[model samples]
Structure formats: C-alpha cells, structure tokens
Target: MPETTRILLVEDHPLIRAGCRRLLAQRRNFDLQEADRGLAALELNKRHRPDILLLDLDLPDGNGLDLMPQLVADNAPVRIIILSMYGDSGRVSRALAKGAKGYVTKNDDPAAILTAIDKVLEGEVYLGQTVAQALALTQLQPETPGLAELGEREKAILDGLGDGKSLAEIAADLGVTYKTVANAAGLLKSKLRIRTSAALVKFAVERKSA
Candidate 1:
C-alpha cells in the first residue's frame, strides 16, 4: 500500500455506497473515490489510478465481470476486491478467475470488507465467510460436468430459468429472439450434461438456491 491508499468504489446503489463510505472512513491514510457505472468507473480509474478497487459485479451499464480485464490491464498491480450480493460459487469463482483478489458479499459483516482490503493489500487472497463456505461446498461436491464452460449469455439464461421465467419471457427481457434463448437453453443442457429440460430447470433452481 502507498502512504495514502487510493481506493475506488464502484456501486450503483447510493445507500450501499454511503454505508461503505462510512465504514471505510475509519481507515487512516485512505483516499476514496466512487463511481456508480462502468463508464464512469473507467474514467475515474484512468484519472486516479487507485491502488485498490472495490468493485460491484452488477453495474447499470454492464456486468462488472465484463469490465475486469480492461481494469486489470489498465491498472497493473492494483488489487481488486469484489463486493457483491452474490455469494454463489459460480460467481465467486468467476470473479477470482477474472483477477479479483478478494470476494465479499454485501450481507457479510462489514468488517469483512476491511479485512479483505487489508489482506489483498498484503498480497493475500481473501474470501468472506459466506463466499468461503459456498466455494468449499462446491469443491466437496461432484463438479458440474461443464459448468465452467458456460458463457455469459448461457449463464443469464440459466438465471432466467431459476427465476421461473419461460424461454419467451427470458428472450423478451433480454431483448433477444425467443429462438435465441431456446438455442441457448439447449446449449446449457448440453454443457451441464442434463438429459431433459425439466432436469435443467431443476439444476438452475438448485444453483440459484445455493
């Protein structure tokens, strides 16, 4: 960490940002900046070159996962800690694979955020309690056949299925054709090695519940 750690927090929710701002205020030698969207995050990151980035996975303009490569490339050696509501193994693993040094869920004890920042700054990876448990359970289970191979759209379709949405409804919500969603669902089944649509739906529900 530098003499004054420059931290950029990217989150759309004002209340959440304010809570984090208050929590982070307790730390000495910290300079904090905030951005609510991916575009603004990119701009601020370019200008400030923060030492640490507290990133939220969902942004109004784009998924934060999609923004990770650019941020990592632009800010070499800058540590990233993901602060998300999702504690699921899939999202956690994806975030880590994309270069996040730590994962902390919003529902975790606020201290977990500070702990993650400290640990990552010291060149250690940190997982909040809930995220650690989820990943441990995933490791213990029989791994899903091709879960890691699913692309963003496939994952989105699976999420839609988990929410009990029909294929047509998912297509409309995603602003894609119904056929597109149907094909993606078929691909999802193939990737997950599910024998039937009903089984796929069950898997999606189970994943969401996790």
Candidate 2:
C-alpha cells in the first residue's frame, strides 16, 4: 500500500473542519491534520511537511488566496487546494493565478473536493468546470475588473472607473471587446455589491481617496 498522505487543512469554522476531518478519515489514504488560519497552516508546514494542503480562502486573520506565493516561497514544495464558498470565476482565477494547484467551490459536489485533492497530489492543475471556463474566458476575452479581488487588473479597472470612463469606452481604450468589458462590469457589480454604474464610480472614487 502507498504511504499515508499527510494532509493539512486550514479553515476557521469548527463544524466545517470537523466534517472535513471526518470525510478525510473515511479515505484510508489520508492522515488528516487541521489548523485555523494561514499563519498556523504555514507553521504546521514547517513542522510536519504535509503532502497536501486543503486551504480555505476566507480566514479570520487573512486570505489563503493571497498566501499561495508565500506558501511556495520557501524551498519546500506543497500542493494547495482552495475550498471556497465563492463560485465566481474571478475569485477562483485569483487563487489559481497565485499558484494554487486546485480550486473547488463549496457548492460543488462533495466528490469534487476529493477530486481536486487527488488531481493536485498527482501534479495536475485542477479547476472546477465553471472556474475553468471562467479562466478560459478571462484569457481569451477582455474583461473588466469589477468582480475580481484585489489584483493588478482590479486596480486598473478602479482607476478607469474613478476617471469616469464608460465600460464601452474603457474596453475600446484597453483594446478588449465590449462584451468582455460588460461581463467584467457585471462581475464588478456583483462582487462590489453595487447595483448601478454610479455606485461603482462612487465606490472607486472613495477607494482611491482612501
């Protein structure tokens, strides 16, 4: 039999962690361990050198999506599988762009979680279908930064919005298609919780001033 796979799970919710622990326990190949935050997970990495890390993007102290590069900065190599409540492409893409090995939405079938882990452990990049298609579109099309987390593209979008450019105008200026810009705006509206372009503009202006 293959050796037990040491797994490090980082999540803030106790009930969720307990459920995950139970699920992994049922899989004979895994040896489950748990932590509550990105910092704690990194510490455990230093001591345990786990084979796989099941990371939750949202945490009490910080975000796992932002922690991927740091997790890989050292000489040690660890596979990261992001588990998040967010099913949006922007959020999933952000995690993958930061070097995470896999991404799974909480709403996906439970088997998807296991599948993501297995794929990463086997050294394959994994993104759920919805996330994968989103990334594909992100690469093939032009998009606005409204829904994306704090990233370079997001900053550019904010700057443009703050400067009072319409999505069509911005898309034209940016050399991307109009629909892509519209989609990005839609994402931005949902992510930023703004119902109108005016609100988005206001939010951007305030954010820049702050």
Candidate 3:
C-alpha cells in the first residue's frame, strides 16, 4: 500500500474549491486540505505540512506568487503546482522562477490538473498545454529583436537591468565604463523597439526570468 499524498488546495472561489475537492475525492492516494486565501493557506501549510500544494495565483488577501516562496520554504520536500486563470508567459515564468514545480491554468482540461500533480510529485516541471503553446507562439512571433537575437554584451547588460541594477552599478560590476553600460542600454532599447526605460526594464526582467 502506498502512502497517501497530502495535498493542500489553495483557491479563493468556494465553488471552484468544492469542484477540486470532488475531483480529488476519486483519488484514494490523496488526502486533501483547503484554503481560500493566502494567509489561511500559509497557516494550513504550517499546520498540515502537505506534500503537494495546488495553488491559485489570485487570492483574496494576496497574490499567490507572493506566497509561493514562503510555502516553498516551509515545505522543502514538497511540490507546488500553480492552478491559475492566467496563462501568460511572464506569470508562468515568475511562478516557476519562484520555485513552483508546475503551472496549469483553469482553462486547461480538468485532467491536466491531475497530470500536473503527478508530474511535479515525480520532480518534473509541468506546463499546461495551452500555456506551453502560447509560449511557443510568442517565441515564434517576429519582433525587432528577440532574446535570441541579443549579443553577449547586450545579454549581460539586460541581465544586470533585469536584476534592477543601476547603469553605473552594472558598469562597475561588469568592469566597464558607465558610458559603455548606458550605450548598451540605449542599443537594447532601440533593438527591442521599446519606447521607454520602464518598458525595457520590464522586458529584461520578464525575459531573464522566462
């Protein structure tokens, strides 16, 4: 007899939570708990120490991304699979970067949730089909300059920017002059066809994480 997999379902909607509960009921190897908010999820996580966390990205008290690090820390041996409504690559990348083992949107087949759980439990990273397809399409789409089109220096500059470093700081870290870093930033913005520094920064951050 296999040991039961303890699962904590952290979702804000009562109806959705109930539906998940009903679905999990068919799996004899799973023991499920529930939380409708981030704070409550944290409390239950600390108390129950579940083996797998099926988390929703939007919670009443806070965003699920904010809670992922804490839950991941508290449950080191456990797996976290994000069950969210958002399928955007940036969100998926951030959640995975923050230590989530899987990403699945609400729009995915219901069976995908179970599949994600199983894959993550086995230490694999799982992305829902829709999310994966969207990422693929986004990557294939034409642009002034995609991530793959960047040069080594530009890549390094973008990495530094992504880390929220100042231009001078990046220059110091890279052992280059401030002017050199600034020039690189300008080229990056031009090549990416982005109009503002804020957009460049956001792009770098999202791309680096992705």
Of the candidates shown, which would achieve the greatest lDDT relative to the real structure? 1
* Best prediction by TM-score: 1
lDDT of each: 0.92, 0.76, 0.86
Cα-based RMSD of candidate 1: 3.4
Query: How close is every model to the real structure, measured as TM-score?
Result: 0.80, 0.67, 0.71
Deviation in angstroms for 106 in model 1? 1.0
TM-score of 1: 0.80
In what order do the candidates fall by TM-score, top score first? 1, 3, 2
Compute the lDDT for candidate 2.
0.76
Estimate, for each residue in 22-132, the C-alpha lDDT of model 3 and write its tens digit. Answer: 888889999999999899999999999998899998888988988988997887776889999878776787788898899988999988988888888777899999889
lDDT of 1 by residue, 21-111 (tens): 9999998788999999999998888889999999999899999988999998888878899999999987887789998999999989999
Candidate 1 clashing pairs, residues 3+ apart or interchain: none
Worst 10 residues of 1 by lDDT: 136-145
